[model samples]
Target: MRKPHFELPLHFMLLPPVIIVLIYSYGPILGLVIAFQRYVPAKGISGSEWVGLDQFKYVFSLPDTMNVIMNTLSISVMKLAAGLVVPIAVALMLNEVRKHVFKRLVQTFIYFPYFLSWVLLGGILIDILSPERGVVNAMLGWVGVEPIYFLGDNGWFRYVLVITNEWKEFGFSTIVYLAALTGINPTLYEAAVIDGANRWRQTWHVTLPGIRPIIVLLMTLALGQVLNAGFDQVLNLYSPQVYESGDIIDTMVYRMGLLDAQFSVAAAVGLFKSAISLLLISVAYYLAYRLVHYRIF
Candidate 1:
């Protein structure tokens, strides 16, 4: 029998990421103690007065807390649903395109937006969505429709968040589906055609099932972010006018912790969001394994 060789150089290459994770990710966990204290910057974590569950109590007592939670869940769920469907549809359509140049051009154009930061996109959206002279409003004016205040109106803000998020992200998401589509057995499609199955039938029976594992994986990962409703995008685009619809848990934490200088309350809210995300990830993992027999690990 041959003895296996250990790759010492490869092991050395992994050390930097391990060190960074220890310094950044795992090291910050000790600060979670602030959530249980009336944290003061001058007093420090150890010197701060311990208040136990008081911070959490205060968080739950606020009337805005429920609204924030609802907004976060609603926006996240809408983004997740749209994220999944649009990418899959686009990937399927792209798969049917025989012209390589056109397909590649489309993919390039779509994928480019994902690389642009929300800060940049938010600025562009502000100009494009401007009620007075924006392109969207200008188009509406041409159609004899009233100019919609997309970012300012409470009724339309959440929809804007969902739609814009999907538009920016779907291209990157499609890459995963396209990769899965490539992995599908070509013989399966040939067999489907032999059975008199049309393009739609072949897609329904073969292509979807071929990518089911990837779909389940993406969905499970999305569940882990059920509370994260794009803080950067929302913060950049929303004004006081749409706060009723756009204020999410993360933005609340930013205001309470950083702006208001209530570190304890911020920590408490952060801990709550983390707990919910952890619970969701665990449940998603269990469901994926039990129902679909898919294991991310």
Candidate 2:
């Protein structure tokens, strides 16, 4: 029997990427040590006094922690739901449309928002949703309705964040489902039609089933981010008035650590976020495996 050829040179080619990934990814984790120390940039991490869980205790004892956690969960979950459903709905609608040129044009327009930075998009949202002389308010005024403080009011702030995030991200998710949609065998639809399966039946059985694995994968990935409730969007769009509803873990960390100089406490909060993320991702992966035998690994 002939032995299989081993590509030794290919193994050497892989070393550079491995070295880069280790440096860029794993190297930063060393900073988590600050979570245990009374971290001060001037003192340096090693010179800093070790406080252990004192920072963590302080973080939990604060009134804002629970509220921020709730806000983070609400906003993240809402975004996740909208993020999942909108793309699925859009993909289904697009699949139903036989007009290729019009479909492509719509797709292009929707996808444009995904590339826009939050800084630019935030300004655009402020202008569009501005209470005074804004486009949405102006239209509402014509209908004899009162202008809404979409950004300033706590009640409306979370909703606006979710909607804006969906507008920005759903297109990207739609592209994923669209790719999955194209992979569905055309013969399945033809076969369904021969069996007198109507458009709804054909879609119910064929399209959704074909895309189910991808949907599960996407949902699992999304579940991993149950804590990240749009730092950039919230930071850009929100003011102090809406902080009650809009404050999230990342923003809280920024405020506590960078702005407030509560470095150790901020580090502890960050450490907690990382731990939760890891736990959630593991649970999600296990659930996905049991439900659909899905494994990104």
Candidate 3:
């Protein structure tokens, strides 16, 4: 019998990524100690005095923390719902259309937004939604309705965030659904047609079932990011006027840590958020596996 032996050089293939992961990913985790200590950049991580959970204590003591968490969850959940539904719906709609040129044009237009940075979109959004001179306001004027303050109003801020996020990201999600849609065997449609099934029924029984697994997988991955409510978008689009409804955990961390220079408190808040996200992701992954028998790794 031949001896079971692994190729030595094959193992070397993993070394570069392992080293990169350690340097880039694991290296930053070591700085998590700052969550327990009042870290000064000059004094360094070693010199900082430990304050234990006092940072966490301060975090919960704030009245705004509840609002911040609420904003984060609300916006994230809304975005997730929109992102999941709209893309699938759009893909289905596109699939129904017979004109290849029109379909491709629509796809290109939708996907264009995904490539635009929040910085660029922020200015465009502000210009389009500006109360005095915005296109939206002008349209509302034509309809004899009052112009709404989308960015400044606390009540509308979170809604706008969700909408803007969806507008930017829905195209990417649509691409995934479109890919999944294409993978569906055409024979299923032919068989359905032979059985006298119409387009609606064929889609219901064949297309949806074919893409259901991909949908579940995407949802599982999205659930892992429930806490990340678009830091860049929120940071750019929001102002002090709407902080009550617009301030997410990431923006709050940015403000407290970088702007206010409260390193320990910021780190503690970040660590707490990360822990919750990990817990949520684990639960979501397990549930997904139970439901669909899938694993990412």
Candidate 4:
């Protein structure tokens, strides 16, 4: 038999994460049986009534089901688009900064919020967007405009979700692109410069091409998250008034499963989401591997 190149300790180092994946990820899959059952807490999985597709039928029969699905898709798609554009733009902008001190300070400021939990930021946003005395509304009031209910009004809630999602996520993504930018061959830019390519032309031709692989990789990976519309952020920020625009599949599931105790219905939704996500993730990973030679062991 051929001997292994990696040391045994390196293999041992992988055990913790593997064990966590098993415990948290695979273990819960056993509970998916309730999706086919009319689940009851007192009766439990084995004892629960097996209703087959009735729960799913009931879910779809509701007036808000399609609305919830549409809301989720719209919000997630907007977030995905913004997530790509904002981060790539910010990274390119920051790359152009001449002063190292100022550049680093700006990076730090933007990246700081990425570390904050949505729970904390939700409270801050609520206060800032408050129509009564919030900073944003106060500024609007100064401009002789009425205070806008960003979180409450259906008209603005989806956009608010997108903006806030970008604010929280763009920094981390920007850092990824910045690292990719560093990996690009400096000779390419030098060659472009020697050819009399101006800054904008150079960026358009050379810079964007250099980062294309990273962009493709990120875009492909993002496909798997098409259904996940910032559950924690939406949960924290949304209200009944904004449900028309802000209610997503995750929030609906939370309401059904936890709040309303419709465990079977929630399970069906979870199963549906998981199935689609698994398919998407598989396709995304395959595309990334083929396109960018990206992979995870």
Best by TM-score: 4
TM-score of each: 0.93, 0.92, 0.92, 0.94
Q: Which stretches of candidate 1 lie over 4 Å from their true place?
A: 1-15
Which residue pairs in candidate 4 collide? none
Estimate, for each residue in 113-138, the C-alpha lDDT of model 3 and write its tens digit.
Answer: 99999999999999998999999999
User: Least accurate stretch of 10 residues (summed lDDT) in model 2?
Assistant: 288-297
Candidate 2 achieves a global lDDT of 0.92
lDDT of 1: 0.93
lDDT of 4: 0.94
The prediction achieving the highest lDDT against the true structure is 4
In model 2, which runs have C-alpha deviations exceeding 4 angstroms? 1-19
Ten contiguous residues with the weakest lDDT in model 4: 2-11
What is the lDDT of every predicted structure here?
Answer: 0.93, 0.92, 0.92, 0.94
lDDT of 1 by residue, 1-297 (tens): 999999999999999999999999999999999999999899899899999999999999999999999999999999999998999999999999999999999999999989999999999999999999899999999989999999999999999999999889999999989999999999999999999999999999999999998898889777888888999989899888987999999999999988999989999999999999899989888877876787767
Report how far residue 271 has shifted in candidate 2, in Å.
0.2
